[model samples]
Target: MARMCAERVIELDYSCNGARIRLVRESGQDDARHREAVPAVAAPVVVQDRPPADDDAGAQSLPQIIEITAQMAGQFYITPAPGEPPFVTAGDEVAEGAPLYIMEVMKMLNRMEAEFACRIIAVLCENGAGVEIGTPLFRVERTDHA
Candidate 1:
């Protein structure tokens, strides 16, 4: 087997027969100490020498829909407690500092929030669903409701 190693999470991307795959292999313990991968525009980007599309609706939409991902690995939760109301649901207006939801990773509760004022367009994950580092939990549409 061909070995591909990196200090941190190594993202290997490729396309096969119209199927696209992005393999995100978690780094070793030592690797996490030196380099840290902070979630900042983690969306896939096709970098080309030429300038991007001028009227790029696709490009614009990429940044608008925020991705609440797992920092480590664990089940995702929408409510603070079981049988409790969810923080936000689809079509709900969310503020910048409002709590979007929680991602329980590594036995830790990671509370995710809206980067900016946005409305929850889609809830990609079901309640109590398992998630990895790059897994998308929710997709929010940036709205002017802050």
Candidate 2:
């Protein structure tokens, strides 16, 4: 789906499982020049592997880790604002629908939230740094009830 503004366009795309979604906005172009153009949304892709059973490694399945990624290309902010505590940190327990951070695109602050509860294992991006669409922001292990 897409929506067009005066000089920008916003689009949303999702997968069958809905575990991955992408939101992207493009601006700075003349609306008249790209009125008919449709922005593309890229969904997160995952590939899994299984080790041979004869290997010494345990037979347990690999933990399902979800990588929280940036939906748009922009600057990422860990804190709500300067001088404020971060919305979340490594080892933090994130609740579903809770704001995880912010992404600034085209001078607009877009709150990026979690779709499911999870425990943060690592933060992949630095605060106030530029991030591209689908860039991994956090590595998290999904909660049992997620």
Query: Best candidate per TM-score, number?
Result: 2
Show where candidate 1 strays beyond 4 Å.
1-67, 144-146
lDDT of 2 by residue, 31-108 (tens): 566454323432232222333345344433445576777777878899999999999989999887788888887677
Model 2, runs deviating above 4 Å: 1-30, 34-62, 144-146
Position 116, candidate 1: lDDT: 70
Best by lDDT: 2
> Relative to the true structure, how large is the alpha-carbon lDDT of every model?
0.65, 0.71
* Inter-residue clash pairs, candidate 2: none
**Tens-digit per-residue lDDT, 1-146, candidate 1:** 24655433378788989899877777455554656554532321112223444676755544445555555556778898999999988889888778867766446677766667777777878899887766677776667522
- Whole-model alpha-carbon lDDT for candidate 2: 0.71
Candidate 1: TM-score? 0.54
